[model samples]
Target chain A: GAGVSQSPRYKVAKRGQDVALRCDPISGHVSLFWYQQALGQGPEFLTYFQNEAQLDKSGLPSDRFFAERPEGSVSTLKIQRTQQEDSAVYLCASRSGAGTDTQYFGPGTRLTVL
Target chain B: TQLLEQSPQFLSIQEGENLTVYCNSSSVFSSLQWYRQEPGEGPVLLVTVVTGGEVKKLKRLTFQFGDARKDSSLHITAAQPGDTGLYLCAGHNAGNNRKLIWGLGTSLAVNP
Candidate 1:
């Protein structure tokens, strides 16, 4: 598909378990973003990557949350020692450039912590 | 910190009904966008209003950006069952180049 795609569309993890979610953005897209959305809530920005450089991660909830976009294309978000509060849908989006506001989104990964 | 507040958190109406959802913020924005998300899927961009007081329409949906760039609204006319989804509003932080502040979405359910 030409649009962004996320892997492991659903994940179930136990407390303290670590999990990694993957995102494949549209080819040639330069900006990538990760967001966490709780049930009934809008997506909250977690981090942003401009090519291979992770430009902003201030929105990450904790140190346990980490993301990488090596090769400047596919990205991954890893959360260590997961907590129940971490249960939410993780969404990935990519924009054509840093100057544009339109973002193409992936299907999102729903993480359920128990 | 920038924040967007949406009103009428949840709305349920029969097909062909009309409704409006609002997103308000105290901080100004460079641009505002509206998205629609279905269950288990990410949001799809519906419209982006760049100029204040700009109005855009797509089929039965009409979007308006406040003149102050601090608020926006979405109005649907003769809504259809296919319109059932979560409607979200996001704004480009005027202070940040790429950061977007999002508002709690309005859950819309159109009964047929």
Candidate 2:
């Protein structure tokens, strides 16, 4: 079975440019999560979605960070006017059932702002 | 606020050695999960412990949840070079089950 995957495994964006990271979760998974991980640090939650509805966006650092899962399958994390602080690895994970269930993670998109 | 603190941020040991990583917090959690991540890859779940004072073993890896549900530990016996990577511990709070509170993580290097 195909696991969760992310597109553009590596992205180098100039400062003030915009970037969109894509994630394709496992088929039929209802819950999806986005996390940001800095170098040598653990992942920090960014947002969460259950099916098509975005349940939590509290972890999003600023208004420039936006995420959408319009069709309830593929999720995108968009950063507008990217800054040096936005450079980090963006990870996506999907779960089979409720919150306590195991979450399968994708390879993640490493975004570097130059 | 919930915070998980992991001790010994970095460890380097020879193959066949044993090591234990610890995660501690002041807040109680509904469950705790341990994950291993290699360079250029997202984390892979190793084990999840739900019950207090529960212990679960995965091959050479052992996971234990504290009796108060506020801490956890991972013990790896006879570590191999393949086990080198970042070990992360995440906790699910009862109030916010969907979001995981993660620790700083421990980076282990096993030399053969």
Candidate 3:
């Protein structure tokens, strides 16, 4: 069985640049989530999707943060005009069902906004 | 607002010692989960507690959900060096089951 995976394990972007982090969830998983983890901090929720529909984006810190899961499979978290404050590890997770289902996480993409 | 707070941001102990990590919240939660993460890796789920005052054990690790579902605790006994990592607690509110409120995490270093 394959676990969740993310591409571009490490990304270095200059301030004002745009970066897109990608995540591939387990096959047939119905739910996906994105979280951001700053230095010495726990992961904070960013957004959530159930299939192709984005259910929650309340956790997104600002308008610059955007995410989408098109066709109900892979997902992308895009940060526009990256700032130094955007430096963090972006984690993606997937679950087979709703509610309290255990989430399987990807290795995560470490983004460094310099 | 729902928030989770974890105490003792860091812990260092020798092998075979016992330690406990706490997670507290002011709001009730429908479910609380514990996760362990190592460097350069994502968190891996350890356990999920849904029932109030419920207790579950895995190996020498024990997990407990508070009687009011507003807190949780994780205890590890006979710790090993391999247990060194960050422990995080996340709670899904009783009202909104999808969103999870996360704790800052407790970094534990178990020396051999």
Off by over 4 Å in 3: none
- Going through the candidates in order, their DockQ values are 0.85, 0.86, 0.85
lDDT of 2 at B78: 100
Q: How accurate is candidate 3 locally (lDDT)?
A: 0.93
| Cα-based lDDT for every prediction | 0.95, 0.95, 0.93
CAPRI-style grade of the A/B interface in model 2:
high
Query: Per-residue lDDT tens digits of candidate 3, residues B1-112?
Result: 6789998899999999999999999988899999999999999999999999999999999999999999999999999999999999998887776767899999999998
Model 2: runs farther than 4 Å from truth? none
Expressed as tens digits, the lDDT of each residue in A1-114 for candidate 2 is 389999899999999999999999999999999999999889999999999899999999999999999999999999999999999999999998765888999999999999
lDDT of 1 by residue, A1-114 (tens): 789999999999999999999999999999999999999899999999999999999899999999999899999999999999999999999998988658999999999999
After TM-score superposition, the amount by which residue A68's alpha carbon in candidate 2 deviates from its true location, in angstroms, is: 0.3
* lDDT of candidate model 1 versus the reference: 0.95
Q: Is the docking of candidate 3 incorrect, acceptable, medium or high quality?
A: high
Candidate 2 lDDT, tens digit per residue, B9-84? 9999999999999999999999999999999999999999999999999999999999999999999999999999
What ranking emerges by lDDT with the best candidate at the front? Answer: 2, 1, 3
iRMSD (Å), candidate 2:
0.8
Report the lDDT of model 3 for residue A109: 96
lDDT of 3 by residue, A5-99 (tens): 99899999999999999999999999999999987779999999999999999989999999999989999999999999999999999999876
